[model samples]
Target chain A: NAGVTQTPKFRILKIGQSMTLQCTQDMNHNYMYWYRQDPGMGLKLIYYSVGAGITDKGEVPNGYNVSRSTTEDFPLRLELAAPSQTSVYFCASSYGVGGKAFFGQGTRLTVV
Target chain B: AQTVTQSQPEMSVQEAETVTLSCTYDTSESDYYLFWYKQPPSRQMILVIRQEAYKQQNATENRFSVNFQKAAKSFSLKISDSQLGDAAMYFCAPAFFNAGGTSYGKLTFGQGTILTVHP
Candidate 1:
């Protein structure tokens, strides 16, 4: 089972371009999250969803949007990619509070 | 807000030796959870070990173990018989359960510690 999967392993975008990072899990977890990892920095939560039709902003949610229409997927959207948005993005899911989290391989994005 | 701290930014240990990575957290809630995640060059975050706040006994997984001191808010990872594959970035993360103002399953992570295993 692919616990969690993220698409577009690597991508480069222009300043005003827009894109979406797709994440899906097969574990049927109700809690899903999107995080960004900068060099030498730990992962920073961007957005999270407790279940379908529910989403909340995390520590760093500027310049990003997310949706949870289903339990298996949580996609992150970048409206206007900026240099500051360039970082490695990771998607994770968990069974519930205090449960173990499963992370995807990660997607590396760069904006010039 | 909860926060995790990893004082050691980088460390090196010889192969087959024992090494410890330190971690500390700040939380007002009495019951929570702590975890250690390892990220290799492959960039996949792998769960190494976990500790529950109410469990006095430390958590252990084969060669990996955690020393959880709830009162002091310290949770450290100990690696025995370290191998080359252990060379990677280690993150200390903590989460609260059913905290009134917090989102469920959200984690607070430290800056991370880079471990180098010398052969």
Candidate 2:
């Protein structure tokens, strides 16, 4: 089952370059989230969308943006990448607040 | 804002032994939920167990169980009969809801604890 699919499993970007991390879930869930995991660190919330056209900034939303235009899609945007932005990104969807979440494999990104 | 803390960066246990991972959280809201997520080498976030603050009984799933102390604000996970597959990074998270019950699943996560199971 294609529960959650993420594009570009691995990516390398030069400083100041921009890129988009695509995330889509086939479960038709209403809540979607973006999180980043630094080396040896726990995942931190970047952005979350409760429903289509509704989005909110998470704990570490700086340098990142997200849009939930439909139930199946929630893409994260990095306008000007920096070395600090290098980390593993995960997209997740849940049926309700704090409920079990289905996550994508992850996107490993490195900024040079 | 809520906060969660997992002081231990690493832990280990024998294949057949038991291990408990500690987690503490602080929140003002009375209604909330707690979760333990496991991330193995595949980078897949799997749900280990969940506990609601209002529920007095601890949450248990197969060999996974949680020790939830409401007053102490502690939520620790205990894995019985540990196996090699249980070796992974575990995260403790807490989600709070307001009077209207709209939290968006916003979570405060603790620094993960890496579990090592020695065969």
Candidate 3:
């Protein structure tokens, strides 16, 4: 299986611009998550989905939204990109809660 | 809310030497899970090891092992025969299971510890 896959490995956005970070998994996992990591910092949960059609905000959900239409895809949307949004984003999938999660390579976003 | 903390901001170990990274967490739940994830320069998060709070037996993966002290809420990673490839940022995370049977599966991560391995 390809496991977790994320598109647009790197992106640069100007202030107020918007874009979506796509994430897909072939493992057919029901749990998916979106996390952001600042330089030399730990990962911060942004949004998560327990299953298709169920989405919830995590620790740092402001300025971001997510949708889980299919078990395979859970994309993160940036409504109005700000400089503070610049960070490395990672998409991960797992079979269930507390299960070992498989992570994507990560998408580096730079908002100027 | 549960929180994970890695006291050390950075650590270094010589080739074939041993290194330990300290991680402590605070939670009210009686049962939970803890994990250590390693992120190299490539930006891919790899699971280094995991431990269940209820398990008294420490978890070990080849050269990597964990000292799980449930009473102290400490979960430290011990790396033996440290290799150059072990240089990376290590994250300590703690997760709790939701009561609804839907795994919240959200990990609360610490600030992170950057491990450097010198040859």
Candidate 4:
């Protein structure tokens, strides 16, 4: 169904390097979210977008940024990667408030 | 601010038996939603069940069910007839609506409980 697609399923970034994580959903959902999962830990919110042109920071948005220029695409940007940033990134989307969220397979990132 | 807590970090159950994962949350809002998400080794986060605070009846999906205690602020997931496929990490997540009800997707997740089914 191509519910939520995240590119670069696995990535290795050198310290201080920058990269963008791409996420797209074909469900035409209004709410999109970015989250990171550390090893043996729960998911933490990174960034979220309510709609096109509307974005907000989540619990752990320090080293990340996101933009939602279109309804289907929400990309997270890392300006200067650090070893702590190494984790699995997930993208999710929902129809609206009180709706079920569908998550992507996730992007496993490692910083050296 | 709202918080969710899953006390059991790891649990094991024999196949064909049942297991219950505990979760507790603290929230002042009267209206909210609770969800149980299962993340298998495949790393796919799947929604197991959901419960609304306003609803008095518990929510059930096939072999998965939830015991939602609004007053106590507890939401737990019970897996009946545990199978090897049921082994996974279960996360208890709660979503609260802002005053305007504009945020339908913001979620606070508990640490999660790892379920192991012994065949």
- Please list the residue runs of candidate 3 whose C-alpha ends up more than 4 Å from where it truly belongs after superposition: B98-103
Of candidates 2 and 1, the better by lDDT:
1
lDDT of each candidate versus the true structure:
0.92, 0.92, 0.91, 0.91
TM-score of each: 0.97, 0.97, 0.97, 0.97
lDDT of each residue in B1-119, candidate 4, tens digit only: 77889999999999999999999988766478888999999999999898878899999999999898888989989999999999999999998886765555487889999999999
Task: Report model 3's TM-score to 2 decimal places.
Answer: 0.97
The candidate that achieves the highest lDDT relative to the unseen native structure: 1
lDDT of 1 by residue, B50-100 (tens): 888888999999999999988798999999999999999999999865557
Ranking of candidates on DockQ, top first: 1, 3, 2, 4
Per-residue alpha-carbon lDDT of candidate 3 for residues B2-98, written as tens digits (9 for 90 to 100): 8888999999999999999999988776577889999888989999998887789999999999999999999999999999999999998888765
Model-by-model DockQ, in order? 0.85, 0.77, 0.83, 0.74
Against the true structure, whose DockQ is highest?
1
- Give the range of the ten consecutive residues with the poorest summed lDDT in model 3 chain B: B96-105
Report lDDT (Cα) of residue A44, candidate 3: 92
**Residue range with the least summed lDDT across 10 consecutive positions in model 2 chain A:** A94-103
Decide which is better by DockQ, 2 or 4. Answer: 2
Question: Which of the CAPRI classes, incorrect, acceptable, medium or high, describes model 4?
Answer: medium
Q: Write the per-residue lDDT of candidate 2 for residues A38-74, one digit (tens) a residue.
A: 9999889999999999999988999999998999999
Better of 1 and 3 by DockQ: 1
Name model 2 segments beyond 4 Å from true: none
State the TM-score for model 4: 0.97
